[model samples]
Target: MTTTALGIREYKRGLTDLGNGAYAWLQPDGGWGWSNAGLVVDGDESLLVDTLFDKYLTAEMLGAMQRAEPAAAEIGWLVNTHSNGDHCNGNELVTGAEIVASKACAEEMAHESPAMMAKLMAHAPEMGEVGEFFLHCFGNFAFEGIEQRPPTRTFEGAFDIRVGDKDVHLQQVGPAHTAGDVLAWVPSERLVYTGDILFIEGHPILWAGPVQNWIDACDYIEGLDPALVVPGHGPITDLRGVRAVRDYLVYIRDEARKRYDAGMPVLEAARDISLADYDSWGDAERIAVNTSVLYKEFAGDHGPNDTQALFAMMAQLHKERRG
Candidate 1:
């Protein structure tokens, strides 16, 4: 039992049983709250996907999973879909779980940890509104006690693991949202847990890729036609969910290309593109970052990704939002 601002009550993790001992967890409510994790469990063994932000929230997520399956006693595997802290932090809460993620994701995971985020935020909480939102959004969520345990195994392209009777497939589906993004496909359940590949209701941010890579990723996912698609953020969806993201990417790509041709500035292009389908997503202001990456892809921005530059572009977008 935990005490929330609302009141004290037993922690309830997220959406319950889908089938075949599979369950989905909707993290919490702020923004990182938008991120989700999953459980593939059987009687005695299980696998988990993408732990939440802090130790407390991750513990809550695990506690809920145990309630749903009780197999946390012996979770066979833990697969991280990407390098984002929201997806992989708080891993210390799960005892004896063999962690797994893409090689790229693993490498990136090492670059940042819960402790690191805590430290950075402690010093410059206002580095950017995104960082502030991260702090504010996750402020109530407990990460204070969590240990950062990254994956034990790393695969390059594809890998498969069996938990009791179910098979979990991990596919390296990145250079789209990040350098290395992976998706977990439970063959028997017809479900694909897309880390950041499918944001469902949220705007898709491109951190690493040629834009087309992510577009192709959406196409591959569409071709699979999975019955249940669990996004890194947002509720559970399906093939239609995947197509919606593909459409958004295609539209943005075309829109960005036109701006590139028309010689509009990156920030201007981000504001002008008009992402109608994704206006409902949180952080729609991220369009500037997307435009920056895509603009560089086409017109060539030779400078390395400056942290300052990224935030400036987003700050401009956030500023634009106020007007």
Candidate 2:
């Protein structure tokens, strides 16, 4: 089945042609490891936006794209929006393509290998509730034995490139969702593929944030005046969706700051923040991480996130919510 929004047709899964030889590979109920990817084709060349969480998922997506459009068979360029494993872990499958990403994204990818995920999953059973929550979030995908393929080309700020006759612009608007986030724009098509910068119909996790950077990133997307916005997760959206994400960031930042001023702990602040406005969005537990990051930003802390502790908080929240 397909749903239409502001003239953009969204599919439950698989590729949806966006006219002008552009297409989006959407995964339904976009959450956790489930991400969306894109293809921009012109003549004999095609540029892929991002890949899925694992080889099997990426292979399926590639197969569908190749069957629908021959140019996908020889993807000339693969642009990873960020360092997140879900976006770049499938790089090894797009053979012969010149992989591209932000310089920070490449560096971040080097430190986060699929092996680390595999090891985490391996020990999940021994970790009790955290393990259960981790499995609930990521257990569906395979993480074992996937080779890491670093970007062959890295850039900072903004870079413009071509896919056949079409001009594709890459803008790095990050240290928001991740250390490096990118937006792929096809000017002629008036379409923008916003990596994790926009998460429609879900609470976005702020893994890296000043919060302002992410809010500005939303403004950057709006400034483009995109006719179609393909988010890193969830359905394809328009300017309305972009604004929604920006508003969420602003609201969370302000609310979290209020609690931080009261000297509330990170997890406590996270749990205390009311998500009544976003009750319809999925993965509400991510408020755990979002608040944690915001609290750090408020304190001027530049330290690395305590991943396990964050997960434990999320697990506790998730369990409490379920009960």
Candidate 3:
């Protein structure tokens, strides 16, 4: 199969050097917390786009990077694109680096501490449906030793900074995937590390959404026309990939809207929606959460999500799919 400069289609896990001081760390079958990260190097400085789910995973990525580029051993700037554990749980591993994130993301990070995951993992085996769903979604990572080091610096909108001599643009485009989602755009190299904004081959879970915001995020990516787009999950893609994601969101939103207007329950709508077109996408069970969020948004509800309930519903969807 043909591959893009930083594609992860062939590798389950590893780093791909995109040339000219940019690299992408891929974790394939990008399901659950299995996400991807990026590294930008210039002169003697290195900027880490995001970290992995746990310390060991982050260490392995860093070690691979260090071997490929000696300067990677000391990351000067660490950017957390969002508040997801897969992207920031390894922040503590970067010790002295100046960590940065959007103001909203930093706040979200605090609420989803590593201890939260530890607690969930600890009780997962005993909790029935919620536990089954939770473990099914997040059981792969080691959450015990994560120290939960959040970003030291925060920004509200677009910000520009340097990784050595390369200019990295941090653009906040969230309240979509999360409260704060940023895109790390290396304009000079024509590459963008789109933090959960683009999930290439997987169904993106809408933990937070207006749905339109997520669609707009894709438009923003296409507007940039980056040569390589490294998503928070899945392989690297170009403008076409961005369009696919946008199209999926648009399709689901329209489908869910019709059901919402008819007063269908969220779970029923999720189950009723045909995913035959997206059947090949990983994590098809996420349709449950996506439909639920879309339903809530359609009803003008902006309340906090009932995460456990959502997971239980997803668990049900998964079982149905399996059977």
Candidate 4:
């Protein structure tokens, strides 16, 4: 019997063509180090939404695109939705493409080189909890020889570019997922590629947040009402997926705020608040990161995040969740 006849729709990996010269490249389970990207083709001109985690993955995605649509062989422009390595590390593979990113993303990209990740992984063996957590989250990707190539062009606020005759609109929607996040909208196709802004089946890590900005970003997506929404991670979804993530952020914000008001410690509050509906989501340990950040926001603290402490907390949380 065919796979579909067996009531199983094979979770195929690779591009899903969205009519009107658009495609979404999906990596299933959308777990750690995995991300989704897109291609917009118009005549012979093509634009890539984002690249994969490392060189090999990006090359693989590009190869698939080339086979499916030759226009992908010559990507004229590459837009990185954010600065996260998972989204931009494969940038060098595109060759001569005028890579573009929001100003904030480009700035963040400067310091978050692939070498940084490699160094961390190298030292993970000696750091106990920190090392274990680091490897757990990022050990899968190969980071060698990744000469980080940041966006050559940068834009602030909203920008639009043309792929052949079609117009692709870009909106800077961050300091939500990170310092610089963006959304790529193909108006003609009513398709939106939201970088880390939306994580469908997994928990989102707010590495940087005022929390409110992310919540607002969600509202912005709802306003667009795109017919097909492709998340930075996860399967293609619609407005409902956008709302799901928004609701989650709101839930954690409100819950953590209540605990903050009661003078509960951030760590305790993180462990205390029940994920309730979200317990089923992958990477639930991310709640530790989310709650601490929300608590910081609630207290009016705008200082740089304590990355080590947050990961330590997450490590502890991971243990608790697993135990």
TM-score of every prediction relative to native: 0.89, 0.97, 0.96, 0.95
- Model 1, residue 256: distance off in Å is 1.0
How much lDDT does each candidate structure score? 0.76, 0.92, 0.89, 0.88
Report the alpha-carbon TM-score of model 3 versus the true structure.
Answer: 0.96
How high is the lDDT of residue 143 in model 1? 46
RMSD of 2: 1.9
What is the Cα root-mean-square deviation between model 3 and the actual structure? 1.8
- Return model 1's CA RMSD, one decimal: 5.4
* lDDT head-to-head 1 vs 4, winner: 4
In terms of lDDT, the best-performing candidate is: 2
* Model 2 residue-pair collision total: 0
Pick the TM-score winner. 2
Native-to-model Cα distance after best TM-score fit, residue 175 in candidate 3, in Å: 1.0
**What is the TM-score (0 to 1) of candidate 1?**
0.89
| Model 3 weakest lDDT span, ten residues long | 1-10
Model 4 Cα lDDT, one tens digit per residue, 1-323: 13234322234478777667888888888888889999999999999999999999999999999998898888999999999999999999999899999999999888788997888888999999878988998888898889999899999999999998888999998898799999999888778899899998899888888788999998998898787888998878778889999999988888998999999998999989888798667888888889888887777887878888988999899988889
Q: Is candidate 1 or candidate 2 better by lDDT?
A: 2
lDDT of 2 at 54: 98
Question: What are the root-mean-square deviations of the candidates from the true structure over C-alphas?
Answer: 5.4, 1.9, 1.8, 3.1
Runs in model 1 deviating more than 4 A are 1-13, 28-33, 125-146, 300-304
| Lowest lDDT block of 10, candidate 2 | 1-10
User: Which tens-of-lDDT digit does each residue in 235-282 have in candidate 3?
Assistant: 878788899999999999999999999988888899999999988899
